[model samples]
Target: MADELIFYTHPQSRGRIARWALEEVGAAYETQVVEYGTTMKGEDYLGINPMGKVPAIVHKGRVVTECAAICAYLAEAFPEAGLAPTAEERADYYRWLFFAAGPVEQAVTNNFAKFEPSADQGRMFGYGNYDLAVDVLEKAVSAHPYIAGDRFTAADIYVGSAVGWGTMFGTLPKRDAFLDYFSRLSSREAYQRAGAKDDALAAELEAAKAPA
Candidate 1:
């Protein structure tokens, strides 16, 4: 039970974010890729994540779920990684981390599904509206090199993935700020290593499914 983390993920899911965080932690980990509609929702996996979601991790037999939560948990679980925020930067760190997980995520999901909340219900929704949520995120990233400040932290990994994926998929606008931030985050060595492994896994899965 010495620093053993079992990572449950699918190559094409939000597991990507967890993978990046895992790399950053530099902890000994074993990844189990859950196949969609199969092991993903299997009893074994479901027991670990009742929601049957990928990107869940079991460290020392404790389960952690959700992309953002897993990333935050990993930072604390492996403090030597220096991914957690300093006491002085905790506010900014928690603020934007949850902001991205909630508002930014809501905006992107709504856009992708083409679902619009009634205009009158804007006040009821955390994001208010897609454009407003995006604008707020834009301003946040634009104002700071890293989400919590000049230093890179787990918050950046989580938010950076949102901005990176949103921009690539056109769910969120590709503003200059988002592009620059994503570029910087994507250039990190850990990010690249995680991405390569996931990309290879995705390609292998695709190949396996191809008609011979």
Candidate 2:
């Protein structure tokens, strides 16, 4: 496994996004499940990322963080998976990746965190307002079958997962396009494999914590 990818992650966190991306790339990854009290907050892992976040990756000793960066890196690294776009597709690739990770994520987190921004559009925030961000995403997804237009690339994995999770938790609107796109993404075999593993892991963790 010398050429293997090592992913440090906790299932329920933003790590889910990376998990889906890893599966899409079909990369050989070894998941190190980080327990909350004992491992996730440990000093060693914290040094790898001072933020103490999971979803960090160490592939061939090269470290990468941030969900969108990880997704983009994997797509580029595993070109055989067809997840990466051609040089021609780069603009749309970067655009949607950052859009989902930045605007979409910020809007959902803020809605959950109950954050309110000033009404002024001049404020250059990740998501100026929740509704505005929703409108932006609605128009994009509705415009095409996937975020990067007709291509089903890693950008969809990133953006589709965000849409799926957001709508699942009731933060996002249940628009027809978002619903249909999420349905297609969720039906993918790779997505199912990754999701099943995380579900089992979560169940095991919960069982271990069950009252005696």
Candidate 3:
């Protein structure tokens, strides 16, 4: 069906976020695992996402890229999932969704790349600085059970993924707030289901690359 979602991802990439969102929405989708380097850069996948990034989804012949965007798109596409909030309740939803995708993302990437903006340049950086960015995020998650008010919307998937991956990789500070939020998200059946498949796939890929 044209309405079916076509998900393009790599097991070990941020594609895991999209997989979790897809599971939450109970969407009818098929997965295409793109290999790193040559395969991702090839004409086929590049046509879907010019950036050659994983976690892109094609639905109804339309394409959506970026993890946050995919989560939001899926939430709307599958209203039955109730991942989207009404307009009155959307302020926090949109706020944290973009915050995680923008500032939180900038902070984490800079940390991973070992680049830090000095205090003088903090005003120029979208995330101010890594420490400041993480502190703000910690406060946000600590104040609420979910990213968007009381409901577990798609925003949680994006922000929760950031916290979960950050704590696991030691990229983001493992503050009590982040730890608590991650603990809740990790226990969800959808999260566990998606993680199990990704973990198995990641192991298989790693084993294939190991010296025989």
Candidate 4:
């Protein structure tokens, strides 16, 4: 179909976020698993995303990359899913959505790599410092039932995935607020479904790599 949505991802990456968002929006998408350093960087896949990364989607011949952008794009593209923000929810939606994508993502990755910014360098970095960025994120999740407002939206999928994965991997601190937020998201039927699909695929990939 001309409007078919094709999702390219690897089971073990941030692609899980995009998959969860797809499940939430209830979009029928075909998944293409690309191996890192191989098909992911090969000409065909790279043509879709020069970044040579997973978690990209092609819909109606238009490509969307980055998990956050994919979530936002899907929400708007399928408005019937009701994941898109309302006029009142727009501010908080975009605010925390980009906040998680930018500051939270940077802070968590830097912390994991043991790269702490000096006070002077902190001023230059967008997140200021890992500790400060996490503290702010804690407040954001605690302030609302969901990331954007009282209800679940596309923003939650991205922000919740960050918190969920961070806490799971020990990249982000296991604060009560962060734990509570992700707990709520993880219980969602769509989140569970997405997780099952990815987990099964991950197991299959691991099995293929094992000695036969």
Q: Name the top TM-score candidate.
A: 4
**Which digits, one per residue and each the tens of the lDDT, describe model 2 over residues 38-140?**
6778998887777888889988888999988898899888899999877777788788789888887888888889877777641778577898888888888
Where does candidate 3 clash, by residue pair?
A: none
Q: Name the lDDT of candidate 1.
A: 0.92
Q: Model 2 has how many clashing residue pairs?
A: 0
Q: How far does residue 51 in candidate 2 sit from its true spot (Å)? A: 0.6
Which candidate tops lDDT?
A: 4
For residues 1-212, write the lDDT of model 4, one tens digit per residue: 42499999999899999999999989788999999999999999989999999899999889999999999999999999999999999999999999999998888888889999999988898899998989999999999899888999999999999999899889988999999999999999999999999999999999999998
Return the lDDT, model 1, position 170. 87
Looking at candidate 4, what is the lDDT of residue 105?
Answer: 89
Candidate 1 residue-wise lDDT, 135-175, digit = tens: 99999998789999998999999999999998998888888
Off by over 4 Å in 4: 1-3
* TM-score, structure 1 vs. true: 0.96
lDDT of 3 by residue, 57-96 (tens): 9998999999999999999999999999788669989998
Candidate 3 regions exceeding 4 Å error are 206-212
Each model's total of backbone clashes: 0, 0, 0, 0
Worst 10 residues of 2 by lDDT: 118-127
